[model samples]
Target chain A: MEIFLQQIINGLVQGSVYALVALGYTMVYGILGLINFAHGEVVMMGAMISLSALTALIGIGLSPLLALPLSLMLAMAGCMALGYGIERIAYRPLRHAPRLAPLITAIGVSIVLQNLAMMIWGRDYHSFPQLFANRAHQIFGAIISDIQLIIVIAALCIMAGLMLLVHRTRLGRAMRAIAENQHAAQLMGVDVNRVISITFMIGSALAAVAGLMVSANYGLAHYYMGFLLGLKAFTAAVLGGIGNLRGAMLGGLLLGLIESLGAGYIGDITGGFMGSQYQDVFAFLVLIAVLVFRPAGLLGERLAERA
Target chain B: MSLRFVGSLLFATLLLAACGKSATDHASNLLTVRIGAAAPLTGPQAHLGKDNENGTRMAIEDANAKGIVIGGKKVHFELVSEDDQADPKTATIVAQKLVDDNVSGVIGHLNSGTTIPAAKIYSDNGIPQISPSATAVAYTHQGFKTAFRVMANDAQQGQALGMYAVKNLGAKKIAVIDDRTAYGQGLADEFIKAATAAGAQIVAHEYTSDKSVDFTAVLTAVKAKQPELLFYGGMDAQGGPMARQIKALALNVKFMMGDGGRTPEFIKLAGDSAQGVYASLPGVPLEKMPGGKDFSRRYEAKFNQPIQLYAPYCYDAVNVMIAAMQKADSADPAKYLPALANISHDGITAKIQFDDKGDLKGGAVTLYQVQQEQWQALETVGAQ
Candidate 1:
């Protein structure tokens, strides 16, 4: 029972990250009606930028406390600009073309970004200093770190902020209108291009936050770190019906829980023969099972048929 | 006019003969020995490959400066480098290319996964190939007479780590984790067996893929087992993160790893969490070993980068190859192959001698602890 509770807590912490990244995927998919394959690289870029900021600041004798938030903000700003640039250069030109064209372009952009990152950082892992080290609180036999709590709360805050921005703000209405009917929204003077770009910026910023938190949790960042996380977040987006914001969050948490429990209980029964090495496969199996049973995901919604 | 042209041609022929005789004198004065280095210069393991390359390059330069002699001929060694990208398939192709280039001997294919496949290619071609850092036990077990390794195999290092955990650290219960790769699994198996044999209870055995960043679930379960120590047989990329997560959970259990986690990169990745972690590397810190300081000084001067893990072994591999070639007195692979079998030489890593299976006989292992963000050598255990 303690093991079960422990696994649940572990899953929730991991799930929060997935949820944050997945929200970005679902949001961009909703507004743009295109899968931003480069979203993963955007996350990687954010981590790298934040790492650079932290390293430079620390090298100049600044405390981590002062560097942490500053670096995160810089990362977010840089990623937002990159997101805007990618959408304009890669996707905008093909907005009127066949959907497959933009998809391929997005893939091209992902490759370009990955190679650029490799060239810039080299194929070596870089360590990010722990923003919150040696700090954990025990709750009923399960130990939780301060970073984990921060990750969970930060994810929630980002989710709430995104929800408010998408529902309460004028720009959010414009984005929703564009997603519902592009031609109608354009006729209603929504400035479809501007709204879509804003959507990309918003999604990219959220992914940056996720990247920073993940690097903080792991205490290391690599160019390929974003690949697995991106896949998991994409799975979460699909598991919660792509383009459904709340569904993405739910899917992320659920996926994390399922993976944790699967590796914990089932693995123990097998004498740990079914270890966490297969955790990735287990997560995908859950996705396949969910998709097979419910085509529209947990919170079935018909937000955007194209995506 | 035709008679004058014939006369000019005769005079040119006489001048060419005189020049050819002088060129022959210069050619006889210089003997060039070509050695090949095959490694990943443009892939995921590029950092390691580049380090090995720098060591080999420095060795070649040093040998040339000394004017190495073979059979009374002044021989200058030149390195022919090829990038294998750390892929087995690519390594095989690079091996064939080196053979085609007719190199006297070959130096690398750093990873065992690549080295194993490339070894057969080298053996089939009758080329003597020595790997500096490939430590998979099965690498030397392939019965290839041409395959040789400078470092001890994973089983040896794993046993050393297990013994240290049980005897030195006084850990009664231990949990083991591997990254599910050949190197990782092989070492984990050895560690687990030895740890169990040493009266340590096997609490929980967990495996995670190299691609995984989060090990909370696995760590959480291991925590439940209440182990005194956690042993991870994996590279720094995974081990560093695992260390941080373990510390974050405040488990208070000691963490131990093999040579794979003994890099400065690991300390950087694990931050303060790496403070108390222990790892069993193959040799003492370069500054402590005999001739190590000289090697370090020369290596830094030549490469402009600090000597990384396995750089000394790589330098020694090149030196041993050159020594064997000097003894053989021929650049032909067929002649050099037999000569390398019994060759013994003192190198930066150790006194290098290979058994029939191409395994280094009785290598040394060093235990290191991460203290104040640096790998400080704790103790050395000679091979048993």
Candidate 2:
């Protein structure tokens, strides 16, 4: 029915951003075996930075058309630098320490980044400026807005570009070699640290784009926006099999579908005993079920063990 | 980083020592009257919290400028503000902190959930507390003599909003959504009761969280019900996005929200879709208040931004507290308690007086409709 179709569209749009952010988790987990929890704050940083950049550029009298892309690029660059800096300061210093040390440090970095962002932006819901004229397109009695459409396409194209870069380049080979065995990669002159840093930079850039998509879709942004999103995307990554690229993508989309459909019909499904307020339970429930049924996850046992 | 940390530590120590000295120094002619204010100053609702704080701060500044004497001693009013983060647990901790600091009176904890729990703390300490914005009916019914609010409660505002929807807007079938917060659920329940009693068929009722950013699933489900009007009981953070998404889904129903969505932030977030949306607030329009024009002009001149929602009510709450202290001729909460219970004062918003349950007597409710991205007042109901 149109309701089903509508849920699917919503799923695709939300899932695409989940997939993008999930890649950030999977890529770093593949190489460094750390969650890089601060990556979520990187996404928050992206939104805040891009919003400030857009306002500044527009204030300087540039047309919105020119300002939009320019702001996005600047945000990506800023996130890339942030990604490089976090790895250098937080992870690199503790790379040889006990694994728990870096895991805890990643959480520390996350808190620091969040507080830093709060201090800069001063805790308010910053309404995103309408980028362009919005047009809602109806398909089979289901509606999809232009921003939603762009979000899906942009996410897909970026995912494809990331796939190509991971599979078809010299750096991709180095990244794979490093993920396979850091010692072996280093012995083979792969510059393991450099490759890992680039992986993080690439992942952070994707998070930046996902951040913009999320803020654009909601028509607002805030300092705390990235926390739940980061957790959900991490769930998606684990659900698909952590450190597996294609699995993260599939898991992200499926999680989004499950969330949307479950939220839409929960009231009816439970005979009105439950409502959409319980929507958060869907993502974790799927995660728990996936972990119980297939520990290696869907399409996980027979692929490259890591991204 | 270490040097900066040490420097900040030393600075904090000095400031604390100075405050300790001030508390003990009734040795001087000037008695410092510290008024503790609790509100969320570092979250999504920070704008409103800051507005409340600014109003409270302005009142203190005005009182200091007047050089008021309490019990024949020159009193210097000081504000001791804390960020409750709008969490009840944090609010209790903040209340205890204020009690420890020996503040003469307490000013807030903006949300009903935070305010209700915090009221017990203030009452146990015998500190008079006033809320400028919390409107949950349960707050006043709790038998806490220390608790009072300047704004109308949910039962009154919801009744006004529900009746207006049926009689003025002619909404026969309605869908309701609440953010599941204390204020949201309470207001929605009251509105539903009043609307259903007035012969409006309740089509669907859904719930989301205060932190929700997306409403697509809930809206889609509600859309299938084919209601004539959709009402949401939540803050602007969720309401604005819901408005935008409602348009995206092309759901051809009239959109309405409670006072939580009646804000400039909502208009900015909802963009063009904000037009035609209706909201209800528990007050006469600012321009219609007794001293509303003068207070608004002074507020704008001081703050450099227009008053958002409850600034005048906050202003009134502070002045009413001050009036009680002046009438009692003492800064002690115990001394001022009787005076506050039986006091009537002319405030910018209205002639403020409280019923036996600490509820504002004859509080009015104003209905607003968005036109060209500005809130235009439709009508106010239930005044004296």
Candidate 3:
């Protein structure tokens, strides 16, 4: 029972990161009807940028506590600019072309971003500085580290904040309008391009925060860190229904919980034939099963009525 | 087809022939023995690769300084270094390039994944290849007479670590985790065998990928088993994080790993959590070995950097190859390989000799513990 509770905590923490990254994928797909494959790269750049900023600020004799938020903001800002630039330079040009063009371009952009990060940071794993005090509180004989608690709380706060932004604000209305009917939204005097860019900015910032939280939680960062995380998040988005906002969150958390629990129990359940080493196989299998069973996704509506 | 074009082409061919003849004659006047050193000079493992390359470079420089006269003419040793990027495919390409460059012998292809594949290329061309760091047991079992390594293989180190954990650490129940790489999986398999043989109950066995950053779920499961010790088979990058996680999870058990996790990098990554972790390093520590002090001083003076893991072994590998050449009285690989098979020397690592399977004859595994943020040697265990 303690083991199960421990897995639940681990799953929730892991799920939060997946949920944050999933928002980026879902938002872009919502507005542009394009799966921004480079969204993962945005997450990587967010971590890398923030790490460099934190390192620089700490090197200049600033306290790590003071440097933490400043580095995070810098990373968020950098990722926003990068997201806006990428959409403008790569996706915007191909918006009217065949859907395949923008999809392929997104992949190309992802590769370019990865290689660029590798060139800047070198292809080595770097230890991320722990910004918070390292401590764990036991809950029902299960341990919850301070970092995990902070990450889960921060993720929930961000999700709530995003929900309010998308549902209550004028920008939210414009975004919803565009997702509903781009031509009609433009006809209704919505600055369609501006709203799309704003959506990307918010999504990119969320990804950046997710990146920071993951790096802080794991205490390691590298160029390829975002690949698998991004892949799993994309799966999460699809499982919840791509282009659906709330569904992404649901999918992310569910995927994380499933992954953690599966990893924890598979060895015992399978009598040691399959273990934590095959943990990733379970996630991929979930993805395939979801795709096969429900092509439209659990929460995804049809193309015309997507919101 | 024009007369001028034909004349120009003929003149160019004559000039090329003349240049080739002069170059060959210049080479004949001063015999140049090329030694190829292939390593991942541009990847995550670049620091270690550079360390290997520097060791090989220092050996070549020392050999040249000694002015050994091979085949009557004064021998000038040239090192042909190539970057394998730690990729097995890139390693083979680098091996082919080194062979095309006509090197007398090769000194690396650092990782086991790279070395095993590159060994076939070197053996196909009858070139002797010595690995300074690759410790996988399968490397020497391929029947490639040319493949040689200076350090103990995973079988030796893993067995030593297992026995030490059970006997010395009093680990009655052991849980194992591996990163599922060729090196990690192979080492873990060896450890399981030895630990079980040593009468330790195997309670839990879990695995993770090399790129994994989290181990909480696995640890929670292992925690339930209430194992006395946790043995990991993987490199420092993953091991360090796993150590951090283990500490975070408050799993009251000792940690043990093989040579891959026995570097300073592991200590740095694990921070305060690295305390009391036991790791096995192949061969004796640098300060305790025969030529270790002289090699360290010279290497520091020459390279302006401390010798990372595997430098001393690399230095000895180059010297051992050179010793074989000297004994054979020829720089030709075919001649020296026979000498290499039987040649014994007191190298910086130990008595350098290969068994029939091209494995180190008396390879030793040194156990270490993290104390005060540094790896301190506990004891040197002889291969069983």
Candidate 4:
């Protein structure tokens, strides 16, 4: 049905964003074995920084065509720095302490970043400027906006680029070495700490891209926009296998499609008692189901089991 | 040592100054009357709260310029503003703090969820509380003598909106969406009741939370139902984005909402997609009201920001309370209570008079349409 197609498109767009953010979660977990909860805050900062950068450039009489890409680069650079700094200041210090210590520190960092953002931006829903003219192309009665198409393509390209970066380079080998065995990787002359920082940088950059695209797609941004998104991405990471890169992408898209279809059909399936407000429940339900059925996730985690 | 002697002398001087200032403060306190203005001044709704505060502040300034004598004293009205953060728990806390501060009256707690709970606290303390923006019917139905509002309740505005959709807009099949807040759900329920009464079929009823960002799945479902008009019951923050999303999904239908969507901010948020949207504001358009133009001009000149919404009503609420105190010839709540109960005055919004239930008597609902991305008032209904 056209309705199903429409839901699929929506799902794909939403899933791409989740997939991009999930890569951040999965990569950090793969390399550092820490969840990096504050990655969501970094995602929010990406949107905020890009918005301000775009505004500043446009205010100085630059054309939006030139300003848009330039602003995005600024966002990427800013998020990379923030990602590196947060890992250095918050996670790195707690690395050798208990795992619980780093986990709690990630949460603490999330709170601090959220408060800082709130103070800087004030608590308001700002309307993000549309980067491109939005027009919908009808495919068999299913509407796909230009922004949605852009997001899907951008997400795919980024994922492909990340795949190459993880599989075809010396850095990729070093990253895999560290994930496989940190002690052996260090013995093999791989700088484990630097590799870990690079992983954080790569993950943060992906989140920044996701944040910018999602904000543009939604046409709005706020201080708390990233919290639910981060949670959903984390669920996606866990669903696909926390330490697996391709699994994060697969899990993100699957979760997105399921949520969209479920939200569209749940009311009819439940006989009109429930509605789209219950859509969030589907994501959690899938999470719990995955955790029970496949404790190691769909694609098994690649990290070695510690004694 | 010399340093210790100088520190003791400074402490003694400060003690003497404190004692002297206390005596002067006690006298000044008798000459000043504080009116508590509680609203969310720091959160997303800060603009609305600041508008409410500015309206109250402007009224107090005007009263002082007039130099009204109350209880044989030329009272200088001071506004004690508190931020409720639009939370019910915070509302009650601020209400208690205001009561403890011994304010002569209270102006606002913006949302209905906050106003209703805070009203009970004000009523318990025998203080008059007037809400400028809260429109839920349950706010006044609680039988709290202290609770009053300057705007029409949800019942009147929602009925007017629903009837307009059926009668004027010719909406046959309508869909309803609510943000599931006290205000949003209450208005949606009232609109559904009236819309069904007016013979409009509600094809779909969807609910979303206040914090939700995406409405694609919900819109896709509603689009299949093929409604002629889509009515949203929520604040502008949600309504504006919903409008944009509706357009993004290419759901072709007339969009409509209650006063929550009838603001300049809504148009700004929705951008070009806001065109053709219908909304009902719970008062006559500002240009048509007796004192609205003057108040708006003064407000814009003073605040440097256009009145977001409800500032006129807030100005009137403050004036109405002051009017009661003037008629009672006393600033004490106990003395002014009877005067407030029977008081009537022509305010910026309307002839301010309350029915026995403390509801605004015959409050008007004005329907507006976004024409060329601007809110153009179309008709005024149900004034009497």
Candidate 5:
């Protein structure tokens, strides 16, 4: 019982990070109809930028608490600009070409971003000074840090804000219209290019927040940290139904829970038999099982009019 | 027309003879000694590989500056590096490539899993190979006469930590966890055996993957057991997060880990949670050990970064190899192998001497603790 509750809490905290990153993947797939493989690198860049900001402020004798939000905002802004720039340079040229063209371009952009990060930050792990240095509050026999709670709450708040924006704002309406039918939305006087750029900006910003939270929780950041996390988030987005906003969130949470529980129970059996090295293989096995059963994802809607 | 063609052929033959003679003379003037460095230069373990490479490179540079002589002929040493990518299969391929390249000697394949497979290839080819950091006991137990190591093996590290926990910390009961790699599992098993032999109760045992971040489930079980100490045998990627999670759970149990989790990166990853954690490393820290100050000054002068855990061992391996070459007075590996086996040279880490199994003779393990973000040397235990 206590073990079960504790695993659930752990899963939820991990799920929040996945959900935040998955939202970015789903949103870009929603608007652009292309998998932004470089989305993970964008998250990495945000973390690096935020880490640099925090390190610099600390070096100059400023309190980390005051520098935290400022660095996060700067990181988000930088990521937004990078997202827009990559879309314009790499994706825009191939917009009229075959669908595979943009996908290849995204991969190229991911490599470029990774190499750039390696050059900027050397090939070493950078430790971020602790953000929630000495703070924790347990609940219901499960230990929870303030940072973990912050991450969960922030993810929910972001999802709610995104929902309200999509359903209420003019830009949100334009985005929805574009998603439904790009040609028709253009004919209806919706600036397709502007909406696409704005979609990328919002998604990139969300990834920045996720990156910050992950680095803060783990207390370490590196050039390659985003690759695996991004991969897991992509799996989540597909599991929840790519291009489905709510489904991405659900998938992220579900994947996290499944992984935590799998590690807890299945890990013991394998550890006792073979050793614990096989614990990582459990997550991919779950992913394969989920995709086999639900190709369109758990919450994905059936296409009313299949193209 | 026939006379003109014969005249042209004669002229071309004369030109070829002139060029061939010049090329032959140039080859005879310089003797090239090729040494291969097989390491994980590009992967998750690249950071450790790069440190080892730096030490190896510095040794080669010093040798070249002094000029190596073999059989009364001056020779230049050439280092050829291949990236194994920290995979055993890739390591075999790289080893075969080095063998094909006909390198006189080889240095590396940092991980034991990779080194074990690669060593077979080197042995089959009659190439002498020395590893600076592969500490698994199986690496030496393979009975390869050509294989040698500069650091103490896992058995030594395990017993050192186990003894420390019992004698110094007075731990009555201890829990253990391993990341399940061959290196991790082997060390954990040795530690458990030693602790149990020393009359400590084995309360709980768990395992985690190298990629796992949340350790709440395992920590909760361990906390329920209420062990006096927790032993983790894994690298920093998993160990750091485990420490943080344990602290978050408020377990308050003293944490001890092996050399794999003793890097500065661990402290960075665990933050405040890393404080007061004890670890068993293979040797004393560079600053505190005798004869290390000069090595430190020289290493810092050459490489800007601080020397990492295995850098001194790597330096010693290179020194021992060079010393053997000088004694043999030949670049032929068959001649140098016997000389290398009988080495007795002082190094930055310690005196270099290998037993019949190619394991270091009289090697020691030192205990360290994280004190205010730095590794402070706690105690040293002689070779088991």
Candidate 6:
């Protein structure tokens, strides 16, 4: 049916965004064994930085062709610096104190980032200026906008690039060595701190891209945009196996599909008692189910081996 | 690294900040009375909140220029503004802060969700509270004697919307969606009842949160129903994006919005998609109001921006409260409370009078349609 196909396209576009953000959480957890709750704020900062930059650039009469990539690169670089600084200043100090200390600090850092963003951007919702030509393409009576198509293709390409980077590069081997065992990796003469910082920078870069995508998709951004998104991405990470790379991707796409389909069909499935408002309920339910059935998650071998 | 150290550090800083705002007696040897205004001075609704504050501020400035004598003394009125952030929890905190500051009266807590919770604090403290924009019917239903509004309630606006949609716009099959907030959901429920009563078929109903920006899933479901029109009960922040998504999905349905959606911000967000959308406002169009033309011109002269919705209502609310004070010859709310309940004042919006429940009497609703990127008044309903 056209309706079903339409929902599928919506899900795929949304799923890629989730997967992009999920990669940040999984990579940090893979290295630091800390959830880095502040990762979401980094995504917010990314959106804010890029949005502000793009608006400023476009306002000064810069063409979209040059302005778009320039703003994106600026956001990625800004987020990378911010990611490195936060880990160095907040997480590094509490690394050895206790497991809960770093966790608490991560939450504190998230709050600090949110308040800081409020101070900078104020609390109004800034609508994303339309930059790209989002022509609609009809497939079998289902419509997919050009922006949606770009999101899917761009996400796939990014994921593939990340896969090649982690498998083929020396940095990837060092990252895996540290995730296997921090002390053991250090004993083996690997620069654990450098790799950890690199991991954070890489993850934050991905978050920046995801932030731009989300703002462009929804056409709105605000100081508080990162909270629910970070939460859902965390759910995706947990569902996929916290430390596993590929699992995060699988979990993100699955969660997005589940949310879209559930929102689309819940009224019919529940005989009209439940409505699309319960769309968020589906994501949380999937989280609980995944934790209950498979504590290790769908691809939980990484967590098991690390333990 | 010590938790106690961090905790104590945070506590000390907060203590100092709280102490700085403690109310102090007027040192100017003049009767300084603070009038409090609470609205979402921050967050997505800040524009509306700022409008309320600006209206209140202008009223205070005008009152000061008049140098009115209250209780046989020249009273200098000061405005105490607080940001509720459009959150209910923050509204209560702002209310308590205003009460602690010993304000003579309160102007607003903008949304119904925030206004209702904040009303209790004002009522308990015997401080009169007037909301310019909160339309939820439950606001006055709680028997809060201190609560009043200058605009029509959702019950009245919803009826006007339902009647206009069916009778004038000729929509028979309608689907309703709301943001699940007090104002949005309550308005949608009322519209559904009135539409059904008018022999219109209610095809499907959907709901989303106030914070959500995406509506594709919900739209897909609603599209299958093939409704002739879709009525949304939510604010502009969500309405703009929802409008765009509706256009993108190419749903062959007309769109209508309630008072919350009838905002300039909504048009900006929806862009080209905002064309042909119908929206309802709870008061007569600004040009049609008794003093609307003069008020709008003067307000823009002072504020340097066009009056968004509710500025005139807020201006009227402040002046009416002051009028009650003048009638009783006292600035004390306890002395003037009775006068406010029974007072009649000609305001910019209407001849202001309240029923026993503090709702506006014979309030009007105006339906407007977006034509070529601007809202044009289509018809006036429920008008005297």
Which candidate tops DockQ?
2
lDDT of 2 by residue, A1-83 (tens): 99989989988888988988998998898877788888888998998888999989999999999998999999999999999
- Please give the lDDT score at residue B4 for candidate 5: 66
> How much does each candidate deviate at the interface, measured as C-alpha RMSD after superposition?
2.1, 1.2, 2.2, 2.0, 2.5, 1.6
Ranking by lDDT: 2, 6, 4, 3, 1, 5
| The 10-residue segment with the lowest total lDDT in model 1 chain A | A298-307
Candidates' chain A TM-scores: 0.95, 0.97, 0.96, 0.97, 0.93, 0.96
CAPRI-style class, candidate 6: medium
TM-score (C-alpha, index-matched) for candidate 2? 0.94
Share of the reference A-B contacts seen in candidate 4: 0.56
Q: Over the stretch B1-384, how does candidate 4's per-residue lDDT look in tens digits? A: 697776565556444432211111222333567888998886556667777888889999999889888766677777789999888899999999998877889999888878989999999999999999999999999988888899999999899999999998899999999987789999999999999999999999987776667778788889989999999999887788889999998898999999988888888778878899999999899998989899899999998878888899989999999999999998888888888888899998899899898889999999999998788999999886
Candidate 3 residue-wise lDDT, B296-331, digit = tens:
998999988777678788888889998998889888
TM-score of chain A of 3: 0.96
Scored against the true structure, residue A25 in model 2 reaches a CA lDDT of: 93
Error of 3 at B379 (Å): 0.5
TM per candidate comes to: 0.88, 0.94, 0.89, 0.89, 0.90, 0.92
CA lDDT, candidate 4, residue B45 = 69
Docking class of 3: medium
Higher-scoring candidate on DockQ, 2 or 5: 2
DockQ of 6: 0.53
DockQ of each: 0.54, 0.71, 0.52, 0.55, 0.44, 0.53
Candidate 2 C-alpha lDDT tens digits along B1-384: 697776565556444643431232333565678888888886678878888888888888998999988877887788999999888899999999999888888889789989999999999989999999999999888899999998999999899989988888899999999988889999999999999989999999998888778889889999889999999999998899999999989888999888899999899889888999999888788888999999889999999887877788888888899899999998889999889988899998998999988889999999999998899999999988
| Candidate 1 lDDT for residue B121 | 85
For all predictions, the C-alpha RMSD in Å is: 5.6, 4.5, 4.3, 4.8, 5.0, 5.8
Name the regions of candidate 2 deviating beyond 4 angstroms.
Answer: A299-303, B1-27
iRMS of candidate 1, one decimal?
2.1
